[model samples]
Target: MSRVESAVGVAFAAEAPVLIVGAGAAGLCAALAAIEAGAEVVMLERDPVPRGSTALSAGLVPAAGTRFQAALGVADSPGLFAADIQRKAGGEADPATVDAVAAGAGPAVEWLADAYGLPFSVVDDFDYPGHSARRMHGLPSRSGAELVDRLRDAAERAGAALLTQATVTTLFAEPDGTVRGVEAERPDGGVERIGCRALVLACNGYGGAPDLVRRHIPEMEGALYFGHPGNRGDAALWGEALGAERRFMSGYQGHGSVAHPHGILISWAVIMEGGFQVDAKGERFSDETRGYSEQAAMVLKRAGGVAFDVFDERIAAVARQFEDFKQAEAAGAILSADRLEDLAALAKLPAGRLARTCSEVERLKASGGTDAFGRTFSAGQKLVAPFKAVRVTGALFHTQGGLAVDGSARVLRPDGTSLPNLFAAGGAAAGVSGSTAAGYLSGNGLLTAVVLGRLAGLAAARLV
Candidate 1:
């Protein structure tokens, strides 16, 4: 809880080897890695606690070739995972960064579970979009809050100094872009200047900044901002001022199934499990299975900025595994009926159109044919009786673009050279996703968080 105080106007001398801004998954993991490497580390958090964008996520980190996957008889490898990412991103991602994350994800997950004692297990029940294997690892409760909490506890236990309510606003660096330290402002208008041998920016992205979002991803300007409010593009701004390169400025992760009025997130499992989304007019618009991130724009435009997610009892059972879905059910965001017309009545949709849509879906399932929107219905995954529905809206979860970095997460210059003693991870760095929302593979955010975080921590410690 102590901020190394300095003589007024004189910057504090280097108090630690590595100074990390932001205490989310990326910063916490970076601290753990630096501490493990025998470097004194200090993690500064703007908020009173460590929960950031990681807490708002589903707590799933997809990693190929993990022991949990092997134990479940699932075959996978980093090569396969990297290929999937490239395919999803349309080959727009940096090859080295993609390969590094895919290769490091498994080891990072295993390390967290084995060393930190986090109860992580493979999510074998269902598949997220763009992931070819059952590689998502999560805690027992499948909640991001639990993931952040456990990581925080582990980091503190491992001797990393976790300081809260320290909002870093300025960087103290040499004229040549060699960062020496930062200036963090407290709520009481007190300034704390902390110096370090190396610096890591894990403060996340700019989804919370309206101006930045409008400048980069103009399409999602009106959608609900579901990410942490503290993500104000601090890293990008700081990097730009320091002459660090930035890439994929338009990439982001958006969700299509946030339950409206109640503000609860309904898992996309409902759609992936053969359920469908309908507009207010009670008609299927786009291919719901294409990917949930892309589905956000479709839901907003095709569904008049709002829609209803229609699924059956079986899909609901699959969705019940998520805490957010359970919370949605408790909030009355989920409606149920045994028949399509009854369901339509509860949702106040056109009953005739709803019935016809259901019949068309059934026909497509029986014939195994593609619909007008080009979505092929699989006969094996059919929606049965006891239908459930949730009124939903689109939401911008987080930004995926920021300061460009090398495989080791060293902040790079515009000419592809590394900045001295500066690193970035998680949302603070450009992600593997390409320049659009469609390129986001499932769990790519956390993938970079743990993988690049550890890499940055180790690399920074070596520099120290």
Candidate 2:
């Protein structure tokens, strides 16, 4: 397909106006937005495959008051979205940044659909934990790899050039702290300094760096790191060296139920439909109703870093409706049983205690009362005779902290002054959640990637 015309309908000059580092979702979205604003753009990716953590995600972006939600007869607003966030984070997030994300969320999702023809639909089955409404937009295939590919296609069609295998080492700047460009080294050990009027750091977080992980979040220091390998604290190191203000550096997102041995992620729909986590002793330690990210530490310390996600055949049937679940099942990531006792045997646990534990879970679900660990059951679904289960463990998926930015995603100094011509977005920027795992709402990752990226692009375009 031919490249789509620029949104401004103005051809870019010989020299581009914007240079973006890290050609993941943030860089690609920023490139598209800058091109639409009548600026030529160049994106650099260290990986030859041009992939990052975005490719490993489930591709859920929560957008309030979107056209899709309206079509479904749902009423929502940015105010309500902000309110929801504040409530989830206990009012610990930066008010300005939260408001900016809330306002741009619905438009960002629609823009992806209207401009790039991305196939997005609202997830309507059930709301995730901590979210009060159904506002997540995802692809038909429900794959984040597809989302990254779509963004790359859109950026290319908009005339933004993406270069792969270009490792950005550091930022070049004037004495006044104005970013001139970046110095990138080629795979062959050749270095080139690429200059631009504006530079954006979309390089993501430091998930792959063990030292940084321990420094910022000591709680998850020794846990399994499951994020993309390219994230090695480039953004944080560069930002700190440049004297950028760091906010909420302790926050991170954790996955409590990773399908191990087979390497595919088991969808949380199993838990959403009355599933529960049990140890080998067939005892429940913590509430499984908390969102995956918030429950990671609990699962790790309480369940000995290992547990089994036990669900019924009916819940499996509903979960298997999704492509990921189907693929996981086809890959032998799940075990099936005709009877609860058989499932217990497959899980290598005593059938008697497991039966009693499941009975208690069912009672809690029906009663709607809080459990000992403070988990309240919402869905009335229960585990019946036919059983399905997956052995799972906790892992750190993404860091929820990075360079702090202003309303327009401009990197700021410690005193709240914007750094000249320096911007950040996506995992490169501070997340919207509070300073811990307990505050992560569903779809916060992509919301920051898309909304902040668009804002940064437009703001940078006007400058250069």
Candidate 3:
């Protein structure tokens, strides 16, 4: 597409008011928020329109304690939400950021629902382990693409210009250390420089960059990329080059999935449904029914850093009852084997070991020693006859590290001093959840993306 570098002259020219890098959910939201705040915004995206990690996501927006809850007679508060997040994260998160998210989350959700026309419904009595209330909201489309489309439309209507296939190569900064704009690579191998008073980077994580992965998350060294192909950490690298401080560089969200023989992204959540994950010797490794983050940590640490999801025909049938399983299958997130021996052969595990594991699971079910989420499984729900197995491995969705920012979304230096005229939001910013698996809450990513994006937009707009 065409790129506009300068609308007029050098200094004091009427260029785009705000330059946003990455057209994913966060970038789009930032652009829209800036435009809504009366700023002329320009969004540059490396990929084509309507495709990114956001499009490939299972969009679940979590909102806890709001006016909608009061109408539904469900009680909740920001304090309760903050307490739950901190408790679940095991005190590893930044209290200030966590508090900010809790306090702003309700209003953010309200904006998404009321202003953005996002359809939402209040779920009842369905609370996460540490949640104080049943305030989790699921999108009607249940795909991040849906939300992105909505935001893109809104931004367009608000006069924000979106340029796709525009890859930002460098971040432009003033001599005073203020970020001025970005330099991007066009589709035809030409470079375009766009300048603005404010710049926002929301280009997502380093899942696609093996070098960054090895440099940061050492435990996931050589891990296969399960994120978007275009997500090569351009934003992070550029930020670092611009002297921005980074945090949690070694942290990432590990997803448990079956590594098909041909290398495809499979969902390990299916295994938690009715299948069993075991080591090469056919021994059950970790609690299969735990939260995804906890399960991912266990799978990565144990089971030789790889495991197999063993299920039977009956169990597979039962697994198909859930929407996640269906989506997993549609997304090629599951592998199949007809018999236990065949699956063992495919997975490179010993057939004898696999047989032993199945027998143990059956025994556990009969004796009521295996619950759904670490409880004993009932005998009636035991798997029968012909078995199946899928070779499983760990993958990542997003990075938990980036530019360290405070409650106001002001980018901070390693010395904990705020950077002037430089702000960060969304996944581009360091997250509140620290290194704890329990603290890796769902919907928090999107929450921060919207909340901090708005905060950063407002903060940047006021600078003008």
Candidate 4:
């Protein structure tokens, strides 16, 4: 299987102590950490532009017991955070992995900000289902592209070699199952060998690969995939060949309010700030108070696999703060109207049903009672005049499954043996979102990416 091209050489790989595959949040965090720990680092990215699932995210990661949380007068603990994950996941996710990630979440996020100088702030006003506190840490621009660009710059400044447009075909290992180096296929039909004391797999999930989805996560087979096409399950494939165990293969995160034609994800914050989702029949099918990922299956099973989200001007004002929502508004994808009839006409929906639904939402808010879907709206946060609406549908974001790894981010075999000199993080490792889409706590993906990436990097550098 080794076809050595003339241009490919092992001299460069010989000098690098750590080799990271994938340039997304996980790989970049690994590179930064490994380099900071006094080791030579090199990163490989399959995409020419290097935008992976991390760039598709909202650039928010949940952290408990951070300085920001403490400053906001919100008392939170890693125990509480892990308990929230357990409750949301119904305890299907591995308890040890959840405990490990939760234990390191605050330190991982704070280290990135305080040490690497990544610009991040705790979203004190934001709230999500399953979390008792406002612990979402977001970038200033609320754009994951900015987050990627910043990490790229930071890694480069720290002297980590980032090689793009190179796809690692397979791992080079000894007969005793000790992984040694990687063989990458270049775009020009060349093979490059990069040797390292340790290899880290950060390539994201398999959302772009329909066959993989059908095999592991069958429920998301027909839905629109909003995640990057770069997530082709390279990690899982490689793991299988290396005799690694897979876990959480059925779990995923789905977005319920993806703007159909515009390709913009209407910010979930809109729903948190008094927005509502309605079907074409103009009736509220489910409670918008549920997590966006949790509502995806219901939205997809609806009559048209589409829904309209309506919000008042005040909620829209908060939504406008997000970059994606602002872009959607500028593109005329977001609709605004003062009258319910006119809004229904614009959306080609039933005006009468829309009116009744709006009234019911307000009544629920005023009465402080549980909705038909078992969702409750708080008092004094009622929707008011001048409504804004967007035509939306459900979409698969990322898979929450892959190779099962230990708490320190070591890939494990079926007998619970760690793969020697190999590590996984981000989408490559099993996530804490249980075994279904509904288990995704807000920001779980990025939180795991940051924490496990750092831990994997630090540990791998130690091995070198």
Order the candidates by TM-score, highest first. 1, 4, 2, 3
TM-score against truth, every candidate: 0.97, 0.95, 0.81, 0.96
Better candidate number, 2 or 3, judged by lDDT: 2
15: Cα error in model 4, Å: 5.4
Between prediction 3 and prediction 4, the one with superior lDDT is 4
lDDT of 4 at 155: 89
Go through the candidates in order and give each one's C-alpha lDDT.
0.90, 0.83, 0.68, 0.85
Minimal lDDT window, size 10, model 1:
1-10
Q: After superposition, how far is residue 218 of candidate 3 from its true place, in Å?
A: 1.1
Give the alpha carbon lDDT tens digit for every residue of 1-464 in model 2. Answer: 00111112222223346999888788888888899898888898999866798888888888899999999987888998998887877798889999999999999999999989998998887667877778989998787888999998888888988888888886666655776666677889986666778888898788888888999988898988878988887887778777888888888888888877666767787887788898768888887777788777877888888888998788887776466677788888788898888888888988999999888877887888678988887645767767888988888888889888989999988899998888999999998888998788877888898899999899899898
Ranked candidates (lDDT, high to low): 1, 4, 2, 3
For 1-464, candidate 4 gives per-residue lDDT tens digits of 22222223334345357889898999999888888888899999988876798888888888899997888888999999999999889899898999999999999888889877887787766577779888888788888887888888888999999889988877766644557778788899997877778889988789989998999878778889999887888888888777899988899999898997888999887788767899989988887666889678878886368898888888888776678988898999888788988888889989999999989888988888788888888777787768789999899999999989898889999999998888999999999998998899998899888888988898889888
Q: Which whole-number lDDT from 0 to 100 does residue 450 have in model 2?
A: 87
All-Cα superposition RMSD per candidate? 2.7, 5.5, 4.8, 2.6
lDDT tens digits, residue span 35-138, model 1: 88889999999999899999999899999998999999999999999999999999999999999999999999999999999889987777888888989999
Q: Is candidate 1 or candidate 3 better by TM-score?
A: 1
Q: Please identify model 4 stretches exceeding 4 Å from their true place.
A: 1-15
